[model samples]
Target: MDYKYLLLVLSLSVILILSTAQHENIPYEDVPDICAKCVCLTAHDTDKRYHHLLSCTSKKFQHILARWPEEFGKKHDNVDIVATFSGNNIELLQQLPATNATLTFSCRHCGIKYLQAPTFMDVPFIRRLDLSWNEIASDELTPDVFRGPYRVTHYESIALVDLDLSHNQLHALDRKIFEHTANLTKLNLSYNEFRVLNAPTISALSSATELQELDLSHTAIKSLSAAIFKSLVNLRILNLSGNDLTSVPDKLQLIGRSLVSLNLAQNPIARFTEESFIGLKSLQRLNISYMPVLKTIGKSVFTRLETLKRLDCSHNPKLVEFDLESLTHSSNLTNFDISYCALTTISLFVNVTQESHTDIATLAKPWPHLHTFQSIGNPWYCDCDLIQTMEYIGTEGDTKINQARCDTPYFLAGALVSNLSSQYICNLKIPKQYKAILEEPPRFLRKRYIILTVIVAAVVISVGVMLGFAIAAIRRRLKRDDFGVEPIRYTSVRSSNLSAFSQGNTNSIIVNGNGVANASA
Candidate 1:
């Protein structure tokens, strides 16, 4: 009876364990439709949903569509897909099988030589697309390269928001390339061979009216048409650095309403006039560094930028004067860099932080918002005037001023201004007496020297007379001893004392009581 009960209990435990295992395997059965779903990896989200990610990067995929899996898209209609085909050997990208899904596709570094309308026929929605580092040419591509047969309107044809086509050999671009893609917000076409951006190019780019961030750097672009960027009214960050621009492009005024950051570094701009930045009232950050030929900048060029925060004007060795007064209107300035500009004095730069320099009532403290001043690599004159400025630096705790080195006044060369001594400053200035003498004539100097000599001689004669009287008084006191000196004043000695004076000498003196003196021979 005991063995029978034990067997029954063991069977019941085995059945319970099998039931739990069956329930755990039910989720996989519900997930179907795996057609052409070549997911490289799958990740679980916080809500326990699986995200399918596919990448053919560096796989040397040739004609990816030809190798499409047979079981792709079996049951599922909508899915999340992230696809990458970078660093592949795919030359031509033709029509892809249609799918209604959110997608992010990257084809950078793919040796694609041709792209047709059906290239993305299967892909209707693309949030981000990267086609950089390819061999696509401007003339070979049509404006409707991404247009699908079913997409009738501009919004239905192009759903791409971010596109990158950098590092290509494109010399000119067609306006129709972006005509169907009016919703693009960010575009990067940097590192191309575009020599000039004329009216046609500007008109072509105007189709994307909602563009916010654009990068055109290192493109060898020489000039831009006036008001070329007028259509991109929503642009905020524009990068034109590393170009051949000779001046601030006049077309920038079109986007001045919303531009926040402008990079103009690595150009050959010779001067900055007031009209150069006339319409950049909303600009906050400006980079004009590394300009080899930049020498002159107008005093009021930055007056319009009332909300300016950071200004980088470094690495321009020919720049001499940067009028701080012109920036009085820029009350929101925080970070300023003027390093390596060959400045002769820190007076102009340092004094701008004081209350006397600006009329802004909000600036109660010295550079209240300024955190860093990269003013190093400049030839600072460390005279008495600069010493006062250094003291202010040591006392102020908020401002981080560094690399404040001296380049002139041989004694203070290579020395930091914060460590200078008071004695050294005093030694550098001329003495008051010498300075006064230098101002006087030679005839006045001679008269002054004669008067000084006469005063010194009179003082010496007075001292000599007082010394003679003191010596005579001392000698008279010695003569008035207790001995009788009436008989002879020669030596206070009597006749009996004559032997003590003579002894064995033949010539001797003798004195009697009658006060007469005789010599014995």
Candidate 2:
């Protein structure tokens, strides 16, 4: 009896193992009835339920006649359906099949050109629709393209919270295009051909009062209407990069109450006036990088940005002057990037006086809360003021400074600002009266002095040798006069005396007192 009981237990254990294995390796069922080329499966959701996922991607289908299996909702307990029909050749989106479950549809890169009216009439519960990377034009995007049929009294509105229409050929949208998507929270219109977002197009988006994020990048936008974004009161993030804007969009104060992150990069803006970013009281992150023609950030340009934290002005090749005092109002700045610009000094940050050419005893610290300061890739002129500023930054708090290498004062060129001392930087600038206390000159100056000393010594040695040779020649001439053969002397001898001299009479020849020749005689 005991052996039989053990055998039964072992058999049951083997059966349980086989069942678990079969469950784990169950093949995803194909839903040919809905989309001949699609696969439908139930995925475990975070809410402890299974949601239907209908994937029809990369199927070279021209159209889909979705007819969900009769028992689909019963099997999945009426859970949501996330459908993807991307990478297809569907030119017109007429309508989606009726379904009992909420839907999230994506048809990216579908070559879709037209969206027919009542496109979502049968599936009015769509929460997200992505039709990006299509050939849809402005004229085809009629106001009722996203509309559904009426329920009983009023028209049924879509539950759409996110809509992506990027990478299309749309230049202008109908004035009431978003009338059915009033619940939209995020809208992406990037990579379009909108050279100018006209007033009517801006008014069309007023119905989406709940929108928080909008992407309009790479749209070739040259300017914006004064009230373009005025109705988007809840907008938090706005991207206007890769445009042709010459200045900041006007009347940003209309959305100043809720705007947070703003990106204006890759534009041709030349300068920022004091009122450039005015009324942006709630802004935190601002990116103005990659502007080819930007040159100056004028004083108080960032005046009203008291809540600003991170600011990126990097990669502006012509950006030379930035009024650091303009950042005084933004004391909460934590990350500041000014890299790859044309800045030549850090005196603007340290508030150094050019007239005095002296370091301040108590420097004005602009960004007290700054933690990440990237200032590299600039033409930094390392001087007394720069050294002091860098020293103060290095010792104050835990701020991280990516110091720029020097580009001026030939001696300190290519040297990191953090590695230099005030003595080395001020060696050439110290007053002559205080030279006694100054450290040795920089290596380049010392090298110059050594070369100058060698040249002077060589010159002096040459002059001394020439003078010695001249003096010796003079002395030898005197000695030759003293001991060499004396000139023939004749002391006024008469003709008779001359005859006697000729006859070798020694007494007739008379010499001068100094024994010098008398040519007159």
Candidate 3:
């Protein structure tokens, strides 16, 4: 009788153990507002939920959905428990409350390109998305793949905002596929194997009219045409870093009202010509950093960026110089970096944080609001050439330098010239390095000798020449005056005794005739 009672007690205990295995359904009232119909066992009040399960945040859930999951009505009444996708488990997506999806993921071993099919709509709550890392690559797209927002079966309005398809092995994307995501705000297509993008692809994005931020970094886009970004008029932030862009065409007329930030860092854009930044009037920050081969800055290359605030060009080793004079007039520039370029000194007619010329004593007018300036790895010649600029910079504030040495002029290298001497500038370290240009003690003896020699030589030569010429002229004039008169010669002689002869002719004709004959003879 005791054995029978023991057997009945063991059966009752087994029945109670089976009853414990059943799940106690928590009422809907106990769930957070975000998880009323959702099966999240742990959702805080801060959890977000949309009429269409907008996103699952704050809680980790393993979702499980059948390939042919039943849909009850406009609101999905049936969604399974979230589960992990493992090898032994049947391949399945969790759930979708929408009718379409743009599949983008990468799973190399499984040979899955992307699972962007309407079959995912049978899962629950997903409309648009980013499948960045799962291996998924498909070339041909059936018409069923492009049936997300176009189908009016689900809602009066679609709930698609952003899509990211980076890190996938996608080689071909039909440009027409973007029309289905008209409501998307941001699209990330970076880190893929796209050598060339057809023009119609960007144009289709323009037709979308809502894409704000587009990241096309790490593409092999070799060059840029005029209308490459023509369709993206409303794009506010564009990231084109890590590409092969050598230059930007002039036809890139990006309007000011829409664009604010442009990041083109790490491209092989060796040239920053005047027309490089043509029509971007309202740009605030421009990052062209880490470009390995960018060698130089063109004159007025950044002229059109009137509203620019920050310009970063820090890591281009071949960039040897800059034009500081042209940018001295710019009032909007505040933060400027040109570190690691082969800079020798800070002269005028380039983009700079200050009017960075050397050897000037004081500022005619200081840049009262300029913030930072970077000039390192340059050949700094600390002669009379850089005294004034060095002094002015030291007076204004400390200019930070790193691993830079002045390389020239037989002396004064690695010796800090920023504050060595105002009057004299010599070997910047030895004997306190004082040897001035204009305001040192004069060598009176040597200067006097030189001055006297020049003055005496000039006066003596000039006086000697003048005196020689004057003496010669005076001698010639005196000789002409003294011997100017000429002597004249004349002939003399005669007598007339005709009257006396005539009067005595009567008395003494014979004697008068004889006397007249003698006189005549």
lDDT of 2 by residue, 144-186 (tens): 6676655433566788889999999999888888888878899
Give the better candidate number (1 or 3) by TM-score: 1
User: Which of candidates 1 and 2 is the stronger one according to TM-score?
Assistant: 2
lDDT for 391 (candidate 2): 61
Instruction: For each candidate, give its TM-score against the true structure.
Output: 0.66, 0.70, 0.56
- Model 1: lDDT to the true structure: 0.70
What TM-score should be assigned to candidate 1? 0.66
Which candidate, 2 or 3, has the higher TM-score?
Answer: 2
Candidate 3: count of backbone clashes, pairs at least 3 residues apart or interchain? 44
Model 2 ranges off by over 4 Å: 1-41, 68-78, 348-369, 393-400, 422-424, 427-521
User: In angstroms, how far off is 370's CA in candidate 2?
Assistant: 3.0
lDDT of 3 by residue, 300-416 (tens): 877677777777777777776565544544556666676666655565422222333333444443344446656555566665435445444333543344334555544555665
- Order of the predicted models by TM-score, top scorer first: 2, 1, 3
On lDDT, the leading prediction is 2
Give candidates' CA RMSD values in order: 23.4, 20.0, 25.6
Worst 10 residues of 1 by lDDT: 26-35
The list of candidate 1 runs beyond 4 A from truth reads 1-39, 44-50, 65-79, 149-155, 346-363, 384-398, 420-521
Q: How far is candidate 1 from the true structure (C-alpha RMSD, Å)?
A: 23.4
Of models 2 and 3, which has the larger lDDT?
2
